[model samples]
Target chain A: MTEYAGPLPTPTIDTAPFWEHCRKHELRMQKCLDCGHVRYPASVICPKCYSENSEWASMSGKGTIYSWVVFHQAYGAFFAGIVPYAVAIVELAEGPRMLTNIIACPLDEIDIGMPVEVAFEDITAEFALPKFRPLGKP
Target chain B: MGSLGDKYAIVGVGHTKLGKVPGVSSIGFNVLAIKAALEDAGLTREDVDGVLVKYPTSGFSSLFSGKLCQALGITNKLMAVIDLAGATIGTMVQYAAMAIDAGLATTVVCSYGDNPLTGPPGTYGRVNSDDAAFGFVGAPAGYAMAARRHMKEYGTTSEQLGAIAVAFRKHASMNRNAQMQKPITLEDHQRSRWVVEPFHLLDCCLVSDGGAAVVVTSAERAKTLNKKPVYVMGWGQAHPAWDIAQRESLTVTGAKRSGEMAFKMAGVSPKDIDLAEIYDCFTYTALVTLEDYGFCKKGEGGSFVQNGRIELGGELPCNTAGGLLSESGMPGMLLLVEAVRQLRGECGPRQVNNAEIAIASSQGGILTTHATLILRR
Candidate 1:
């Protein structure tokens, strides 16, 4: 795992479970029990059906790059050394999209619609970030 | 359905010197802008009975419109603190007009101010998402991602985006209050440093320290004010989705619905608008908004902006006061101020000839929220 100095996210009551799953390298998300709808960032109610009944389901950890950008400038000291890194919106196979960093691939090679899979990077002792690497990478 | 159209008019507009005004707090800018707006209307603090402010609200700060009213030493019976981000100003005007129509207050003042440049950078309001943990830093990166998607879907070229900056810079050279007055060609835009991929340094707006305010009153009472009344012909506000990454289409913006509402209410079309004070936080933003607002078909904004179609005296002039690109970046209220000035025939050299009808579209939060207004003489 690469060392990270960026600010860590504080888990909320609704989102703590997702982070807990991430720490174990298991990708999980809330699925609406009433409508079989899936949601990201762990919401209590379904956006499509407004159903309060939900359950956590493990994801396949597969997604496609919907869009990406290369940050040439760093807004903080932690990113100074990582200038020109790629951040992308990856659309998971289950229908929800997430903002994540594309790793293990050259920044110039990242493009929309490229297949990718999640890789766990333990940035801290208590938390591990779910980053994406190009499919088939070792 | 009843409408607030033609019932209210912008009687006065005021702005402080934009770009790097030291020793001014955020609240101080509001007071300065309000006082100037009142003075421009030939009125006093007592004449203002309603107040609306944007920013430092909605988890940003404890300060609200009531506090701003207290700071200005005025007792307003009707006041609100709107937190729609860049759409704050555009939405504020709508609420002010509704307040007037509802007999809530006679005269309303809408204002906003921030010292993002002179004070701490990134102090301006931005969407706080979990994406921040993934190094999604600020508005530039979020907007850049959308621009990239647009390029992929529509084949939008960097040069087409550059044309927007060049047009705004050319207009800014004619205005004294513009931060960047020197003309920049497409080459100049291409040669500038990249802030993020697909966005050059010139493509971004100036981080400015300033404030702007406008007075809204009934058209019946505006005849007694000091300036010519710019009637609010039509206005609308919309939020497609708050989350930028989850929008159905990256290129489509809230202006799609908001602009439609405004035009339908005004009984006008895109061809009827003589000038467009559309938000230009970035060059691509203007292009996308132009398409979403029906200025052109979708994916044709790149071509619609080329060949000086948006320059002064073109088929449709945009950013007449250089907009946020060349003027101050105090959000979209400045666009309202410039639109009113153009309709009143006050803009000296950068004025669009016989600009009787104008449209100003303001967006906030990575194109999440939008407000459109059609103002006429």
Candidate 2:
């Protein structure tokens, strides 16, 4: 078990849906209605066409290991024991990249373009962090 | 429009001591620098009607801003915090100009402060995200990766990278305020421990705790300032793809877009620049910025920095105060201060002779956001 003590992000009215989906172990992205562009950050207007109309769509929660680093230092007192953990940016198949941590895999084995799938770790009673694990060898 | 060539002077500039002052809080540093800037400009706190603040990790807190305002005895003014990551200093300048142009404020103080090097534990920790696996531990490694890619593509040698460190070290020897004044040699740089492969310990920048502030007023108001006003000729900013993989090309940065816009706005060519204070978080940073800023062609930065082209007294003198590589690193804010100092002819031994035009460029994040400013005497 890991401990987290930093301030938790409050899901405002605009961002509640995204957080709710994470709680349910689902990846959601905002899809623009005007130009059919998918956006990672939930926004009121489409970045491409500036349209206010948008919809939330579920994603496969699959992406490639775009880039990552193993932090030797702990982020906070709560994570002091978890030194030397790997964090990474995953490029979703839908074209949005997410900042996430890679787990259940050896650090040395992580590389660019490695296939990964999202896994939820319920940290607090209300929040579940989205981590990733390597896809099993076929 | 006024001729872009005309000067747009910097009325005031201020810098806090560069080191671990544990007793001083972040807001304390901001107020200290701002007060110095106000006095340097020979104005009262009430004279400042606009304010712009930028913090490293998070945006400014209203409580912090209010504390500084009360300490400085300032009340009732137009203000906004600019949170553009590394380009905060330049963006602050742009916002101040907008305020002046809009008649909302007369004198605007743009300031930045941080104490990461000596603050509470985990002060420099990475943001909570999943991207830590590739050992993207910190800014140094992120820049090291860029250096490695540059080497793989352009045959940029480690020796050439050392030249940047060595040159900046030489420049620091002449700057009393520079944090690291001891001279460094290529041998010393090569022998330094490896923070990340292809980037020796010397290749990384110092993580110092400090703050920097600059004051901008209308051209008319600047005429009465105590010090010579170094004009803000032009400024521009650009955001490349947020993710490193999404970049069109890693070696080339969006600095080109910002540089081109700044140059166009100032109506000056790269050759017109008498001096430059480009951000050098790593050796390759300056190399890539040189190409991106149009000083040299793309893919030519490796060779361009070789043979002391960027050294003091070179055709294009750079980082005359040793930059972040050798001097104190204040998150690229010091680069702007050095540019202002050089244009004002305040730099004694390391000053560029007859330096009438100067340009400064800074990038925040992993080359994701870039900002450039053109200055003139």
Candidate 3:
């Protein structure tokens, strides 16, 4: 495929590991050493206990749909032709919410508290976005 | 007996033509707004010791306020650009009063200017953020998600959200100066094209080119001003400072704590507020704020907004100048300006009768920050 025209994440020193995990199709979050609070998007310090000591813990990639919206308006060039995309805030079982698209499902069928699991969509050879799909659906 | 309550007052308010201005750059509107507000206050730039501006949202530069002051050929003892998004306007008044109390400056000008409507095509549509990578890059999407959550949690219907649009549009219809003069019905809101699901075109605010400013001075000094000074009885701010996905509840907002602090400072409660100029960036934003501000219980804003409860002449009239829904979408500064006007009884047809007390709310960055202000006639 040519270069992916949609938006892409620029990994920082902190978030590089998280993005790398995504490329490898592994879900991991930073859990504080002191407080055991898990966080997303890769942070240096624990927001709960201010602990700089933390480790990347593998996640189960399962969650519930806290909420969702189907955006009809294209906000950028990449979305100009293909809008009406549904975006959801999926609250992972690990207790952190992720902003992602719900795929492999009908838009009208999406609902709050619906069980879901991570499904990776590889945009480029080395990059993948972790979307979600209805639980137990092949 | 709050130390800051009733110590300062807004002496003047000014704004540019709403919706469409052909050639005015962002800073050009700031210059125009400050001059008009100064003239309205019967004062000149020389009398102003403080200048706090919320710069154009479309773009930003370090020392933007410095550039604005240089354009106006004025020097001030206190100057900075506040960047709380829509909440900056109400928070500016609080900061101005603090500066005055601390003897840093006596009289202050708080203003905002933007040209998103007329400046460059797709200016309002373009949203650059980390979330863009995942296919969400617009304001409406975030609010629509929150609105969707509110619906699922509280049985809030699309019609309930329509009440907000219908009410503010009705108020705007009565306001000749509003950008949208025609009143819309619930059916119109339902029929409007979807910007995002759970949000029609009516659910979103106008993209406007505008500049708005207000002059605040010591209450004692306001006694000498030309207009009937609207006293700044109370001011408070709250910023949860978390991303929407990280929030504890989508329906609850920073306005909850912000309003509590302001009402506590003003020695009043939500029921004491005769008129409220809430920042209605969208209909759901205002509805939830009405709940968070304690006007009604949590999860009850849907019913509370129905039955003519939030329109003009209703109990606890809100956004009588049409608000961002129908008025110019100048962020929230215009809401503060309108609140002052209503308190002064200057709103020709849409004024809240016997409006002795009013509360103006400003929420910034998709309900991430909030500021509440209580004023007295």
Candidate 4:
């Protein structure tokens, strides 16, 4: 197992639920009750309707690549072993985008609009990060 | 609203010798840059009744402006600190103008200084985020994603992106104060190592240690100052989104709105401006801003930068002082200083010919915050 040495998420009140869901290997996002809009990074109030009424909805775990980058250099000591890895922003089918790693695909093969599904990687004893791998691909 | 009515002008501009200075403390650079700007305006510290200081990446104090004012022994009625990241400088100018307009103060001094080279290697401790865990480390990665999207959407090519670095280096070669004075060919940019995909090392701004400051006062008062007044024809700022993932569109920026407001306020269009001092943390930043600021049709930034159009003496010369890429990376305020200097006919070798009106646009965060300013002689 590759040690996840990068920074860990410190769950604030607004973001704790999102991480808690990830620990259970569930892709969850905040959906506004007022405007039926989905938001990310887990905010308290709805960005669309400014309503405080919101609920957590389990995601379909399906999305497409919007954009991506391959790190040629390690930005920190923990990430030194993971040079040349791809970091991508995945646009969920529900219209919210989240940052994740595109796994199970060769670095040279990743392309915009590639379909991917959520896969949980146990980074820490208490937390499992939701990463992505190409759907229906080994 | 009506061309700012000659209401405020940048009376003076000053910059500390940009690049690494071994022992200068962060605040140490601030004091030096502020003193130099005060000297350029031929006024003592006492003449400044308002102060604004851009928060440094390190050693950012909540009372930054107050501390600077205290160091100079000047009592300022309006003192503020802004943390717009790279866009702080341009925003400082906008807010300072507002302060004078509202009678909070008369002469406002906005200053920024930092020693990032002496700070941590990447400028801060590791950023804690889910994205950071995935090696989405810093500005380069975020910008690379944006560039990749631009390429996929608009067919922008690496050659077109490299043209920005080559042109800015050509301009920087003529600027004695520029950090990278050696001119680079397009081949040099193409061959440079990749910091992140779609962005070569040459495409990024320099990580330097230096300071910059500017003095803003009413045009009536500025005309009596020692230096020629560079009038603030108009200014506007917009922050459509803070996070990169949340932005409505990667290809557009808040500049779409901010630039429109600024041009309307300046009573000028992109065609009327003679030059642009755009924020170029990365070459793509300048390219995208040019598009959003109405310099070119959307998605044509790649083509607009081709064939030396952005080089010195080219039509609508940009980043005439080499910008952050080849110039010092004191963030975006230095662009304002360069715009003022260019309007004053002070840049000896890199001066834009007959430069009457100039625009300085800045982007902060991951193409998040934006500010636009129009200046005229």
Candidate 5:
């Protein structure tokens, strides 16, 4: 019930729908109509095909941990209490990467290539951050 | 030799007293560095026609380099700011040569200065909106992830990273002006506290208040100057241009292509060089960049740096002035400055023996951008 004191992404004209979809607990990426390259941090054109035509496509939000780090030190004030937290680069099943947090897991339990699925954290009334958790087993 | 190779040369190099220079401002550092460099080149402020600056880390302005010109009380035919983060220094030199080559300017001074040590609070921990929401705020988090991945992929131990810290600190002990003069061992590296997982305090570069500058001119003009000219043998730049998440492989960096471009232009290979002034933003960076430059095989950096091979008398003396690890962490400017000094035999204690050619590398944005400058005396 407390307000989110940490930083949040300010939606741009192009990135608006991505966040809008997140608020609805639906993870969507901008997919190129020409080459079908799904991209994050939504852009006007697809990096692979350079096509202006695109769609807000749905994602399974299931991914394997490509890489991760445990932050022993927090640089900002709000994060001071969380001395040790894990931020991971998730390789989505749909073929795009997301910079996100892996929640519902201990630090020692995380590893590269670990299967995970998306779980939403409603940090604020207006925004819901998409996090990940261990899928079933190690 | 590559086109435009050996065509330009660095005539002078100078730096402000590094390590906790508390009272001077960033701009003050730049001006002092320029004055010292000009004196080294036996030239006056009037001799400078172009000025390229890597804008101060602590401030921003529309005409930042122009502001530097105004501070020096001179008009420049060409002036601009370069912003490639740690790669700014090498980029500045390249831009200066191109400007001079096109007849836009004759003599150019490239410089960078920062006062983060004495700057206002929150300088080191400014809020980055992109990753801050995920309980990450500092610069180390991004690199920590990279270091961890390297560890997983190559079986690179924390001890392997410790070797890099040890070598650089040993070199620092010989450098009188280096920030961290006390030599530390691999055990000492292990004893240091962790700022981020997979990264010890010693694994990071020293933060300091300092400035460094170099004077660049045509090779012909450089020969006429007061001191020996460090010929600009070759230069090249490359950028991944993607965030860490989007990159195909986090373990690799652009240093591979950039180093090749420079070596081709300089008509040399990695083994042809005698010294390497690599940017050590993190211990991981030093290891990975050397690997990317073909100094050693991929995943072999940890072992390649194990012995005294990178030391002063070793196969390839690297970071002879301690680099960003023990030297002032002013991005990559000081690396090139040290390369210039080593080629000129200006370094008394830490100088490499009979140094002929050197490669100065600059890295920016979490291993995303890279620039390489090859120099020879």
Candidate 6:
């Protein structure tokens, strides 16, 4: 199999826990203490309530494909081998959306509102990306 | 707003040449545009009391801001660098006006400069984590997705999208400074290759290396300037959703919020707008913005452009200076300069006759951020 090697963002202090959970093969998002709102891309405070009291909670990793596109060109050399991959914005049941690549499925099968479940790919020592596949498929 | 309608004005504007000028440096182009703007305003460097630098794609810090001031030989002045992405240029005008309104500075210069084409390619890195994995790479791909969605949802045709390019090219042919003035036909646009599905090569904007600057000052101070003063009548901004996936609707935009706010502030409705300089990063951007701005109903942008509403002699003469699609894309700063020129009656062949009120709306960061400004003569 081809290896994935490219520059990855170093998780900062505020975002370290989220990356840690990703390493553990689980997707964790921040939930506001005051409003009970779930958010993504971990921030210092809740955007809704401005409350700093928040914690990382494990999500069910189930969502609908909100929108997607099939890329016919390679954006970079690292992904040049993976042309015609589907990138989708999944609206998680927890209320926040995440951008991720859909794998383990045919590109023609991808459709908006298709039910999906999280699948992890251990790409590197420090990172295990959270990709998605159809709910019942391998 | 204040009682000064048609009072506070843009007296001077300067723009660096477009396209790959690898011989020039980033800071060099910035300082050059600043000096040219100051000269255009008929003011010496010493007369500048405040500076607002909008560096969208650069590392703008207090040190850099101070370095620009020192290089321009302007000392003992208040300076700030505003980074608002695509709206950086239009927001500079609003920020300068606020400074004058609050009596913080008498004369202010807002400028942006860069050689996006000639610089080391791919230096900015991937904008998002998923972009690299799925090949949704740059702005073109991001926008191409939106265009596809718009067509899928509203029955918008590719030919209608090409009409925007056609209208802009017609206007660009009249502008000497426009980088891509060569005329193109609808067949030509369709024959062009595809960067993304449903969006051909002509639907994308050309990357150019250029800089543009504008001078904003108090109403009373502008009267004494040599050039015609294009008044800053109103301004507004809005952020619909930072992430495109989470937006309420993909076909619409947050420009409606900003455009409504600007119209209310200016006390003028859409019918009162004589001309417009909309941000056309892609043809769909302008089409969606037009609908969102209340110029046309939602899902009617394709038909609106087909009827020649955005052409030179049409009801609303839009992108008369040949938008970013046809003109040089100076990170959207030129939109403001072109709007000011149209209101001042300086656009020779593309000028809209009896143009009194003008509007310029800029969309930045994949429709994540937007800013609008109203100018009056």
Per model, kept true contacts as a fraction are: 0.64, 0.07, 0.77, 0.74, 0.72, 0.16
Per-residue lDDT of candidate 2, residues B89-169 (tens digit)? 777887788777777887889888777766664536645442342334457656665666677677788888898888888
What lDDT does the true structure give each of the candidates? 0.88, 0.77, 0.89, 0.86, 0.87, 0.80
Write down the TM-score for model 1. Answer: 0.97
Ranking, DockQ, top scorer first: 3, 4, 5, 1, 6, 2
Give the total clashing residue pairs for model 4: 0
Lowest lDDT sum, 10 consecutive residues, model 4 chain B, at B119-128
Candidate of highest DockQ: 3
* TM-score to native of every candidate shown: 0.97, 0.79, 0.98, 0.97, 0.97, 0.91
lDDT of 1 by residue, B272-295 (tens): 999999999999999999999899
Q: What stretches of model 1 exceed 4 Å from their correct place?
A: A1-3, B56-60, B120-129
Clashes of each: 0, 23, 0, 0, 0, 0
What's the distance in Å from true for residue A2, model 3?
3.8
The digit string of per-residue lDDT tens for model 5 on B66-100 reads: 77898888783688888787888888999899888
Name the lDDT value of residue B341 in candidate 6: 81
Name the candidate that leads on lDDT.
3
Task: Spell out the clash pairs found in candidate 3.
Answer: none
lDDT of 5 at A119: 92
DockQ of each: 0.62, 0.14, 0.77, 0.74, 0.72, 0.34
Candidate 5 local Cα displacement, residue A123, angstroms = 0.7
Give the per-residue lDDT of model 3 (tens digit) for B1-377. Answer: 24789889999899888888879988989989989898989999889888999968887679998988888777746899987888888899999999999899999999999888777654356555558888887688888889999998899989999999999999999887789989899999999999989999999999889899999999999999989999988778999778888888889999998988898889998888999999999999999999998999899999999999998879989999899999988888888888998988999888888889999999878688899999998
Global Cα lDDT for candidate 4: 0.86
> What tens-digit string does per-residue lDDT give for candidate 2 at A93-125?
888877677899988888767899988877666
Report the alpha-carbon TM-score of model 5 versus the true structure: 0.97
Ranking by lDDT: 3, 1, 5, 4, 6, 2
So what's the TM-score on candidate 2?
Answer: 0.79
